[model samples]
Target: MALCVMMFLLVIPASLAQEDMDDKVFLFPKDKHTDHVSLTPNITKPLEKFSVCLYFFRDFLRNLNLFSLASPGTGNTFYFADSSSTNTVHMNQDSALFRTNMEPYEWKHACVTWNSDTGVVKLWVNGKLYPRRVCMKGSSIPAETSMVLGQKQDSFEKKSTTYPFVGEISDVHMWDYVLTPEEMLQALNKNAHGNIINWNSLLYEIKGDILVLPKSRCPYQITSKSYVDNGEDVDNGEDVDNGEDVDNGEDVDNGEDVDNGEDVDNGEDVDNGEDVDNGEDVDNGEDVDNGQGCL
Candidate 1:
């Protein structure tokens, strides 16, 4: 049962193997540090109305790039950056929305949903909705553009490391439509799946000394359900009272009185109810006669 819970709750995580991932980081010198994710088609793509979400845990209070989905010269430019530790949301040519509550050294669920028709952008941080307007304002993201992560992109090949991300990022998802606040909350629970980028089986490339780390806590969990007995029975998959248990509505005596009873397999019943569930009950419904009853 514990193993089943563990399986549903976690998959042992790719970040748990980050010790081996060190060999894959760009490993640039500290004097000139750089860490980024070079976007392949699967990482980022152009869309008119879209929403993207990711889970990030920053290790330091430095500037960093979260996502850079923009064309340098001729397309709609939309980007997110942690400039000087201030989470800045940018769209189009130099328009930006600044956010100031993101904490360093913590895991955060960040989501941005945008629509080109209205140029409206909605940012969700850990499931809280923050709405804005008219940033890109009727421009479509270029189909073939430079998309990068972990560093602010000045251009396709030219990215600024002044805010190079130093930490772990995971659970990235992108949908071609704006996600509602409830849907964004579901993302925090890892309940929702992205049609564009499913983080469970993601394909991307990481650069520099950025190390992927396991999430500090499991993103999903199963809560024990309460039985029908109201608060009368514990929710440990069993019900001892009027409530129905997950196994069935089997009744269990608490032994508070001397006549308390135990679970009946082939046990006796005082009411002559023939608690008999085997033999004829198990064998062709003949009779209570011997029919070689097996559990």
Candidate 2:
């Protein structure tokens, strides 16, 4: 997962102390979707005009949250997926025009801008400008923003979380004012600094098991029902032996045997033992092999 975020066009020179840590890769474990990074508030006076930018990547459409901004009464929810679309860009308590198509498993840049002067909000994906939306006109977001990332918050101070993002994210940046197309293009091409949350000097805290990778090679293994092989839905999280693809309905219901194999039943009780997983046999489902191997 790589999120390449940039800010204003003018790249300000910073001290050696203000650089992104070489530790760029932060891996959130699949088992711990509740994990998140809580950022200290950006105490920059009037929270009127601002934009949140980042790069993200994932392979599933499972209601992943990208960011949130909550005020006293009104708030905005930025998310990736909903019940409607797989790759969506949605906002809350706003208007009707807020949706975009974002592909998965590839790095893509996204930015959302809100201006209180005109109560206009806009979103940009890659380099395209989406339609401007009307919301919170002439009003500033609460100075004390209940900001959150990688999870959806339904209330201020992040009181409720209904959706948690499961993927890799990076290069987060926030700007106090909207960036011009030229500035946006410059930031997209060159390096820039964030008035607020700079990826280079990011201030954040991690919760739960989030693997921070300093290298490009990943060592974690994931085995699940969604694993696909050459357009075949053959893997339902079951084990395979000696490079042999054995899931062809050979061990259930009919108890029929077409060839020599293990776990083949003959209507007579055959309780095959639990299958080995991660070097351990984990029992699941009912073992009715009459006297068979697995129950």
> What's the TM for model 1?
0.58
TM-score of each: 0.58, 0.59
RMSD of 1: 15.8
Report residue 10 deviation for candidate 1 (angstroms).
33
Least well predicted 10-residue stretch by lDDT in candidate 2: 286-295
Candidate 2 TM-score, true structure as reference: 0.59
Error of 1 at 90 (Å): 1.3
| Overall lDDT per candidate, in order of appearance | 0.56, 0.55
Task: Report the C-alpha lDDT of model 2 over 1-295, residue by residue, as the tens digit.
Answer: 1233344322432311244643374565563556776665556586777777776655566557766666556545433332224334444555434556655554556777777788777777776787877776776665666666676556665534566666666667788888888766655543555687777776566766765555243222233333222222223344443343344455433344333345444332222332223232222122112111110
Per-residue alpha-carbon lDDT of model 1 for 1-295, expressed as tens digits? 9999888658544332212221122222232246666554442556788888876656566566677775757332667766434567777675656565676644577888888888888777777776565666676776666666666666655666465665566666778789987888898777887776666645456565554443333222223432222222223333333322222323433433212343444233211222222222222322111111100
